[model samples]
Structures are given as structure tokens and as C-alpha cells.
Target: MLQLEIVTPEKKIYSGPVHDVYLPGSEGEMGVLEMHAALVTSLVPGELRYTVDGKTEALAVGTGFAEVTQERVLVLTDMAAGEAEIDEAATEAAIERAQQQLDQLDHDHDLEEVAMLEAALAKSFAQLKLKGKYKGLQ
Candidate 1:
């Protein structure tokens, strides 16, 4: 098993042993089993899945950094939401809000603001995807 820890600025979301984990990467979704090779990579906003005690759980995570060692996986991100934490209506609103901001952004808007908006869009989309996939199960 691999010790997986996911943390966000607001709290330490999850910490436990997992048999495997799947992350959304810039290139594509990737899976890591126990004793996998060490790696440090950037994570895109998407669904993160892990198996524990023969059951799998999923979370919606924002852009972050992931450190995968021989026995551990550490993920630090701005946002991480489990099924119970995700509110479909709120996520949809956020997506709409992000789109509105992006649409109103002027050509001369600050780069930082633009990036933040983009991140919000990504996070909201991720939540939407996860919710869609596990709606009935949840």
C-alpha cells in the first residue's frame, strides 16, 4: 500500500493507505500502484481516484503538485472536494461565474487575474466531471 496525503490551504483533506491512485495529468490520466517509481509532476484540475480496502473513492482536485515516492503520495493543491463536499449547484454556478469573468476580461487585464480565472474554470469543470460520473453512487 502507499500512504497518500492530500492537502489544501483550508485543510488536510485525506491521509491514508491506498492500493492504487489515479491522477489527472496534463498529458492524460495516469495510475500508480504500490511501489511505483518516484515522480514529481504538476496535476491538472480533475478527478482523483484511489482504492482503499478493496473500495475506491474519488475526489475533485484543482491544479497542484504531486510527489510520488516509493511508499507515499503527497498532493498539495488549492482545492480538493470529496463527494460529500461537492455541491452540484455551487459547482455549476462557479463554472458560470468563471465563464462570465473570462468573457468580460479585457485584453489589458492583469496576467495574474487571467490565470486565476482560468484556474477557477478548470476546478469547476473538474468538479462537474466528478459529480457527473458518481452522481448515482453518491
Candidate 2:
């Protein structure tokens, strides 16, 4: 087993031992096991999954960084939500709002704002996916 800790700005979502962890790496998905190599990687807004005693748990996470070591994995993200914590209607509304803002944006819009909206869309979509709640809403 490997120690896994997931933290967001607001709280520590999880802290315990897990059989394995799958991170949404910038390059791609990465799985870390016990005795894994030590490294750091960037994460995107996506789903993160881990197995604990044969049961798998998943969370929707925002952009962050992960630190892996021989015995532990630590993830620090801006946002993290589990299926039970996600509100489908609210998430959909957020997606709609972000998309509307993105659509209204022009070439001269602030690049930072555009990126933030895009990240919001991605994070909301990821939450929907965690709950299997997407119904052609995007």
C-alpha cells in the first residue's frame, strides 16, 4: 500500500493508504504504486481515481501539482469534489455560464480570463463525469 493525500485549497479531501493512484498528468494519465520513482508533475482538471481494499474511489480535481515518492503521493489542487458532493444542476449551470462567456470573448479578450473560463468548463465537465451525470448537456 502507498500513502495517498489529496488536498484542495479548502480542505484535505483524503489521507490514507491506497492500493494505487491514477493521476491526470499534463502529458497523460499516470499510475503510481508502492516504491514508485520520486517525481513531480502537473495535473489538469480531470478525474482522479485510487483503489482502497479492492474498492475504487474517484474525485474530480482542478489543476494542481502532484508529488510522488517511494512511499507516498501528495496532490495539491485548487478544487476537489467527489460524486456525492457534486450538484448536477449547479454544475451544468456553471458550464453554461462559462461557455457563454467564452463565446462572447473576442480575439482581444484577456487571455487569462479566457483560460480561467475554459478551466471552469473543464472542471465542471469532470465533476459531471465523476457522477456519470452527463446527458448531452455540453
Candidate 3:
């Protein structure tokens, strides 16, 4: 088994031994199993899946960084939520709000602010997509 931990600034979301882990890396999606190579990589807003005890689980994660080693995987992200935890209505609302904010931006708007909003929009969309996939299973 490989130890896995997912953490955000507010709290530690998950910590346990997992059979495998899949992340949305900035470059692409990657999967990790026991004795995987040691490396650190940036993660994007997308679905994160893992297997434990022969069962698969998933989460929608915001942008962050992950550290992988032979024995452990540590993820530090801005946000992480299980399918059941995501509120589709709220997510849709957030997406609309972000889009509105982006539309309202002018030439003089702070570039950093625009980037942040874009990231937020992307994250919300990822959450919605993940939530939708498992909605019927719930």
C-alpha cells in the first residue's frame, strides 16, 4: 500500500493507504502506484481518483502541488471535495459569478485578478463535471 494525504490550507482532507492514485497534472493526467518514481509536480483543477481496499474513490481538486515518492503521496491544494460534498447548484452559481466578473473586466483591470477569476471558473467547471459524473450513482 502507498500512503496518501490530501491537504488544503484549512485542514487535512484525506490520509490513508491507497492502492493507486491518479492526478490531473499540469502536463497531463498521471497515475501512481506503489514504488512509483519520486517527483514533484503541479496539479491543475480537475478530477483526482484513487483506489483503496479495492474500491475507487474520487475528488474534485483545485490547483496545487503534489509530491510523490516510493512510499507516499502528499497533495497540497487550494480545494478538495468529494462528489457528495459538491453542491451542483452552488457550483453553477459560482461559475456564473466568475463569468460575469470576467466579462466586466476592462483593459485596466489587474491581470492577476483576471487570472484568479479564470482559475476559479475552471475549478468550478471541474467540480461540476465530476459531480455530474457521479450524480446518478449517489
Winning model by TM-score: 3
Q: Indicate the worst ten consecutive residues by lDDT in candidate 3.
A: 101-110
Predicted structure 3, TM vs. truth: 0.96
What 10-residue stretch in candidate 1 is worst by lDDT? Answer: 104-113
> 9-53, model 2: which lDDT tens digit per residue?
898999999999999999999999999999999999899999999
Query: How accurate locally is residue 25 in candidate 1, as Cα lDDT from 0 to 100?
Result: 77
Higher-lDDT candidate of 2 and 3: 3
Better candidate number, 1 or 3, judged by TM-score: 3
lDDT of 1: 0.89
TM, every model: 0.93, 0.93, 0.96
- On TM-score, who's better, 2 or 3? 3
lDDT of 1 at 62: 93
Model 2 ranges off by over 4 Å: 133-138
Best by lDDT: 3
Expressed as tens digits, the lDDT of each residue in 39-96 for candidate 1 is 9889999999999999999999999989999899999988899877789998898888
- lDDT tens digits by residue: candidate 3, 7-126: 999999999999999999999999999999999999999999999889999999999999999999999999999999999999999999988888888736578889999999989989
